[model samples]
Target: MEIVNFTPVPALIGGALIGLSAAFLLWSQGRIAGISGIVGGLTKPVRGDLAWRAVFLIGLVLGGVLYRVLGFGVGVDHIQPVVSPTLLVLAGLLVGVGATIGAGCTSGHGICGLARRSPRSLVATLSFMGSGLVTVFVVRQLMGVGA
Candidate 1:
Protein backbone atom coordinates (compact mmCIF):
# COMPACT_ATOMS: atom_id res chain seq x y z
CA MET A 1 0.00 0.00 0.00
CA GLU A 2 0.60 3.55 -0.48
CA ILE A 3 1.15 5.98 2.35
CA VAL A 4 -1.52 8.68 2.46
CA ASN A 5 -1.04 12.03 4.19
CA PHE A 6 2.46 11.25 5.40
CA THR A 7 3.63 13.89 7.89
CA PRO A 8 7.30 13.52 8.76
CA VAL A 9 7.38 16.13 11.51
CA PRO A 10 4.53 14.61 13.48
CA ALA A 11 5.93 11.15 13.03
CA LEU A 12 9.34 12.33 14.20
CA ILE A 13 7.83 13.97 17.25
CA GLY A 14 5.83 10.88 18.11
CA GLY A 15 8.84 8.63 17.72
CA ALA A 16 10.94 10.88 19.90
CA LEU A 17 8.27 10.93 22.59
CA ILE A 18 8.00 7.15 22.54
CA GLY A 19 11.75 6.82 22.84
CA LEU A 20 11.90 9.30 25.70
CA SER A 21 9.09 7.58 27.59
CA ALA A 22 10.68 4.19 27.09
CA ALA A 23 14.03 5.48 28.26
CA PHE A 24 12.52 7.20 31.26
CA LEU A 25 10.63 4.07 32.24
CA LEU A 26 13.81 2.05 32.05
CA TRP A 27 15.83 4.59 34.00
CA SER A 28 13.31 5.22 36.73
CA GLN A 29 11.41 1.98 37.17
CA GLY A 30 14.15 -0.40 36.02
CA ARG A 31 11.61 -1.96 33.72
CA ILE A 32 11.19 -2.44 30.02
CA ALA A 33 8.38 -0.46 28.44
CA GLY A 34 6.82 -3.48 26.85
CA ILE A 35 3.07 -3.09 26.54
CA SER A 36 2.43 -6.82 26.43
CA GLY A 37 4.47 -7.55 29.52
CA ILE A 38 2.94 -4.66 31.39
CA VAL A 39 -0.56 -5.83 30.56
CA GLY A 40 0.25 -9.49 31.11
CA GLY A 41 1.59 -8.77 34.57
CA LEU A 42 -1.81 -7.44 35.50
CA THR A 43 -3.29 -10.87 34.85
CA LYS A 44 -1.16 -12.36 37.63
CA PRO A 45 -1.61 -9.30 39.85
CA VAL A 46 1.56 -9.18 41.88
CA ARG A 47 0.82 -6.99 44.92
CA GLY A 48 3.42 -4.26 44.53
CA ASP A 49 3.46 -4.32 40.72
CA LEU A 50 -0.22 -3.53 40.18
CA ALA A 51 -0.22 0.20 40.57
CA TRP A 52 2.49 1.09 38.06
CA ARG A 53 1.11 -1.20 35.40
CA ALA A 54 -2.39 0.17 35.81
CA VAL A 55 -1.13 3.73 35.73
CA PHE A 56 0.97 3.06 32.67
CA LEU A 57 -1.97 1.53 30.80
CA ILE A 58 -4.17 4.44 31.85
CA GLY A 59 -1.54 6.91 30.71
CA LEU A 60 -1.43 5.23 27.32
CA VAL A 61 -5.16 5.76 26.80
CA LEU A 62 -5.09 9.24 28.24
CA GLY A 63 -2.16 10.21 26.04
CA GLY A 64 -4.20 9.65 22.91
CA VAL A 65 -7.21 11.40 24.37
CA LEU A 66 -5.06 14.34 25.39
CA TYR A 67 -3.51 14.47 21.97
CA ARG A 68 -6.91 14.67 20.30
CA VAL A 69 -8.26 17.14 22.84
CA LEU A 70 -5.25 19.39 22.32
CA GLY A 71 -6.00 19.52 18.57
CA PHE A 72 -3.14 17.30 17.53
CA GLY A 73 -4.14 16.35 13.97
CA VAL A 74 -2.14 13.11 14.06
CA GLY A 75 -4.09 11.40 16.82
CA VAL A 76 -7.23 9.34 16.05
CA ASP A 77 -8.99 11.80 13.73
CA HIS A 78 -7.69 10.16 10.55
CA ILE A 79 -7.99 6.52 11.62
CA GLN A 80 -10.36 4.59 9.36
CA PRO A 81 -10.51 0.86 9.90
CA VAL A 82 -10.13 -0.87 6.58
CA VAL A 83 -10.87 -4.35 7.85
CA SER A 84 -13.74 -6.03 9.64
CA PRO A 85 -13.86 -6.21 13.44
CA THR A 86 -13.47 -9.98 13.26
CA LEU A 87 -10.31 -9.60 11.18
CA LEU A 88 -8.94 -6.96 13.53
CA VAL A 89 -9.53 -9.21 16.55
CA LEU A 90 -7.88 -12.10 14.80
CA ALA A 91 -4.90 -9.93 13.93
CA GLY A 92 -4.58 -8.72 17.53
CA LEU A 93 -4.71 -12.25 18.89
CA LEU A 94 -2.08 -13.39 16.43
CA VAL A 95 0.15 -10.49 17.48
CA GLY A 96 -0.33 -11.42 21.13
CA VAL A 97 0.73 -14.97 20.39
CA GLY A 98 3.72 -13.77 18.47
CA ALA A 99 4.73 -11.52 21.34
CA THR A 100 4.37 -14.41 23.77
CA ILE A 101 6.60 -16.61 21.65
CA GLY A 102 9.10 -13.85 20.98
CA ALA A 103 9.48 -13.13 24.73
CA GLY A 104 8.72 -9.44 24.23
CA CYS A 105 6.72 -7.00 22.13
CA THR A 106 8.11 -4.47 19.67
CA SER A 107 8.68 -1.80 22.31
CA GLY A 108 10.66 -4.19 24.52
CA HIS A 109 12.62 -5.86 21.77
CA GLY A 110 12.74 -3.15 19.13
CA ILE A 111 13.35 0.02 21.17
CA CYS A 112 14.82 -1.12 24.51
CA GLY A 113 16.46 -4.32 23.35
CA LEU A 114 17.98 -2.67 20.32
CA ALA A 115 19.30 0.22 22.36
CA ARG A 116 21.06 -2.27 24.62
CA ARG A 117 22.46 -4.03 21.51
CA SER A 118 20.90 -7.39 22.19
CA PRO A 119 21.27 -9.86 19.35
CA ARG A 120 17.99 -11.54 20.20
CA SER A 121 16.21 -8.24 19.79
CA LEU A 122 17.85 -7.75 16.41
CA VAL A 123 16.54 -11.11 15.21
CA ALA A 124 13.15 -10.51 16.79
CA THR A 125 12.81 -7.09 15.21
CA LEU A 126 13.83 -8.48 11.83
CA SER A 127 11.28 -11.24 12.16
CA PHE A 128 8.58 -8.75 13.15
CA MET A 129 9.35 -6.52 10.15
CA GLY A 130 9.52 -9.45 7.77
CA SER A 131 6.24 -10.88 9.00
CA GLY A 132 4.58 -7.47 8.70
CA LEU A 133 5.85 -7.00 5.15
CA VAL A 134 4.61 -10.43 4.13
CA THR A 135 1.23 -9.83 5.74
CA VAL A 136 0.84 -6.50 3.94
CA PHE A 137 1.83 -8.07 0.66
CA VAL A 138 -0.65 -10.89 1.12
CA VAL A 139 -3.51 -8.64 2.22
CA ARG A 140 -2.98 -5.82 -0.28
CA GLN A 141 -1.56 -7.64 -3.27
CA LEU A 142 -2.63 -11.28 -3.23
CA MET A 143 -6.01 -10.67 -1.62
CA GLY A 144 -6.59 -7.29 -3.35
CA VAL A 145 -7.80 -5.67 -0.13
CA GLY A 146 -7.17 -2.21 1.25
CA ALA A 147 -5.77 0.79 -0.61
Candidate 2:
Protein backbone atom coordinates (compact mmCIF):
# COMPACT_ATOMS: atom_id res chain seq x y z
CA MET A 1 0.00 0.00 0.00
CA GLU A 2 1.07 3.57 -0.61
CA ILE A 3 2.21 5.57 2.43
CA VAL A 4 1.90 9.25 3.22
CA ASN A 5 4.03 11.71 5.10
CA PHE A 6 3.42 12.59 8.72
CA THR A 7 2.27 16.11 9.49
CA PRO A 8 1.59 17.75 12.81
CA VAL A 9 -1.76 19.24 11.88
CA PRO A 10 -3.63 15.97 11.43
CA ALA A 11 -2.01 14.48 14.51
CA LEU A 12 -3.01 17.45 16.59
CA ILE A 13 -6.57 17.37 15.28
CA GLY A 14 -6.89 13.66 15.93
CA GLY A 15 -5.55 14.08 19.43
CA ALA A 16 -8.04 16.83 20.08
CA LEU A 17 -10.87 14.58 18.91
CA ILE A 18 -9.73 11.80 21.22
CA GLY A 19 -9.57 14.21 24.14
CA LEU A 20 -13.02 15.50 23.29
CA SER A 21 -14.49 12.02 23.09
CA ALA A 22 -12.96 10.98 26.37
CA ALA A 23 -14.27 14.10 28.04
CA PHE A 24 -17.74 13.65 26.58
CA LEU A 25 -17.93 10.00 27.60
CA LEU A 26 -16.96 10.79 31.16
CA TRP A 27 -19.27 13.77 31.44
CA SER A 28 -22.27 12.19 29.77
CA GLN A 29 -22.08 8.57 30.84
CA GLY A 30 -19.56 8.42 33.67
CA ARG A 31 -17.58 5.92 31.65
CA ILE A 32 -14.00 5.62 30.46
CA ALA A 33 -13.48 5.77 26.71
CA GLY A 34 -11.39 2.66 26.46
CA ILE A 35 -11.93 0.90 23.14
CA SER A 36 -11.31 -2.58 24.47
CA GLY A 37 -13.83 -2.17 27.24
CA ILE A 38 -16.40 -0.91 24.78
CA VAL A 39 -15.83 -3.92 22.52
CA GLY A 40 -15.80 -6.28 25.47
CA GLY A 41 -19.06 -4.83 26.71
CA LEU A 42 -20.67 -6.07 23.54
CA THR A 43 -20.28 -9.66 24.70
CA LYS A 44 -22.44 -9.15 27.82
CA PRO A 45 -23.59 -5.64 28.52
CA VAL A 46 -25.92 -4.14 31.08
CA ARG A 47 -29.24 -2.98 29.61
CA GLY A 48 -28.95 0.79 29.23
CA ASP A 49 -25.16 0.94 28.80
CA LEU A 50 -25.10 -1.10 25.61
CA ALA A 51 -26.82 1.44 23.44
CA TRP A 52 -24.53 4.31 24.33
CA ARG A 53 -21.42 2.23 23.92
CA ALA A 54 -22.57 1.09 20.52
CA VAL A 55 -23.45 4.62 19.59
CA PHE A 56 -20.05 5.90 20.65
CA LEU A 57 -18.29 3.28 18.54
CA ILE A 58 -20.55 3.85 15.58
CA GLY A 59 -19.87 7.56 15.77
CA LEU A 60 -16.15 6.86 15.68
CA VAL A 61 -16.44 4.87 12.44
CA LEU A 62 -18.91 7.29 10.98
CA GLY A 63 -16.53 10.17 11.60
CA GLY A 64 -14.01 8.56 9.29
CA VAL A 65 -16.69 8.00 6.68
CA LEU A 66 -17.71 11.63 6.93
CA TYR A 67 -14.14 12.73 6.52
CA ARG A 68 -13.81 10.64 3.38
CA VAL A 69 -17.11 11.87 2.05
CA LEU A 70 -15.97 15.44 2.52
CA GLY A 71 -13.27 14.74 -0.10
CA PHE A 72 -10.43 14.01 2.35
CA GLY A 73 -9.18 17.53 1.82
CA VAL A 74 -5.90 16.92 3.56
CA GLY A 75 -2.88 16.32 1.36
CA VAL A 76 -1.73 13.27 3.24
CA ASP A 77 -3.41 10.11 1.98
CA HIS A 78 -2.48 7.92 4.96
CA ILE A 79 0.22 7.51 7.54
CA GLN A 80 2.02 4.18 7.40
CA PRO A 81 4.34 2.92 10.07
CA VAL A 82 7.85 1.83 9.16
CA VAL A 83 7.82 -1.83 10.15
CA SER A 84 7.67 -5.27 8.67
CA PRO A 85 4.31 -7.01 8.48
CA THR A 86 5.26 -9.72 10.97
CA LEU A 87 6.72 -7.25 13.42
CA LEU A 88 3.69 -5.03 13.03
CA VAL A 89 1.36 -7.88 13.89
CA LEU A 90 3.50 -8.83 16.84
CA ALA A 91 3.52 -5.27 18.09
CA GLY A 92 -0.23 -5.04 17.74
CA LEU A 93 -0.73 -8.22 19.79
CA LEU A 94 1.64 -7.01 22.50
CA VAL A 95 -0.18 -3.66 22.64
CA GLY A 96 -3.54 -5.45 22.96
CA VAL A 97 -2.23 -7.58 25.80
CA GLY A 98 -0.64 -4.62 27.52
CA ALA A 99 -3.83 -2.58 27.25
CA THR A 100 -5.84 -5.46 28.67
CA ILE A 101 -3.42 -5.95 31.56
CA GLY A 102 -3.28 -2.22 32.25
CA ALA A 103 -7.10 -2.03 32.04
CA GLY A 104 -7.02 0.67 29.38
CA CYS A 105 -5.39 1.80 26.14
CA THR A 106 -3.32 4.96 25.61
CA SER A 107 -6.27 7.28 25.07
CA GLY A 108 -7.98 5.92 28.16
CA HIS A 109 -4.87 5.98 30.28
CA GLY A 110 -2.97 8.97 28.91
CA ILE A 111 -5.54 11.60 27.99
CA CYS A 112 -8.43 10.60 30.21
CA GLY A 113 -6.27 9.61 33.14
CA LEU A 114 -4.28 12.83 33.02
CA ALA A 115 -7.48 14.83 32.87
CA ARG A 116 -8.77 13.04 35.95
CA ARG A 117 -5.34 13.08 37.68
CA SER A 118 -5.27 9.31 37.98
CA PRO A 119 -1.91 8.17 39.30
CA ARG A 120 -2.31 4.56 38.25
CA SER A 121 -3.29 5.47 34.72
CA LEU A 122 -0.47 7.97 34.49
CA VAL A 123 2.02 5.33 35.53
CA ALA A 124 0.53 2.86 33.09
CA THR A 125 0.83 5.41 30.29
CA LEU A 126 4.46 6.14 31.09
CA SER A 127 5.32 2.46 31.37
CA PHE A 128 3.58 1.73 28.10
CA MET A 129 5.55 4.43 26.25
CA GLY A 130 8.83 3.43 27.88
CA SER A 131 8.29 -0.16 26.88
CA GLY A 132 7.62 0.87 23.30
CA LEU A 133 10.77 2.95 23.18
CA VAL A 134 12.88 0.15 24.62
CA THR A 135 11.32 -2.36 22.28
CA VAL A 136 12.18 -0.20 19.27
CA PHE A 137 15.70 0.34 20.51
CA VAL A 138 16.22 -3.36 20.96
CA VAL A 139 14.60 -4.54 17.77
CA ARG A 140 15.81 -1.84 15.39
CA GLN A 141 19.13 -0.91 16.97
CA LEU A 142 20.29 -4.10 18.61
CA MET A 143 18.59 -7.04 16.92
CA GLY A 144 17.86 -5.53 13.50
CA VAL A 145 14.44 -7.15 13.58
CA GLY A 146 12.92 -5.24 10.71
CA ALA A 147 13.57 -3.30 7.54
RMSD of each: 2.0, 4.4
Q: Across residues 18-131, which tens digit of lDDT does each residue of candidate 2 receive? A: 888888788888898888778667766778768877887899889887887889836336557778788789878887777777888777878877788999988988998998
Least accurate 10 contiguous residues by lDDT in model 2: 73-82
Error of 2 at 79 (Å): 4.7
Quote model 2's TM-score.
0.77
Clashes of each: 0, 0
TM-score of each: 0.90, 0.77
Candidate whose lDDT is highest:
1
List of clashing residue pairs for candidate 2: none
Whole-model lDDT, candidate 2?
Answer: 0.80
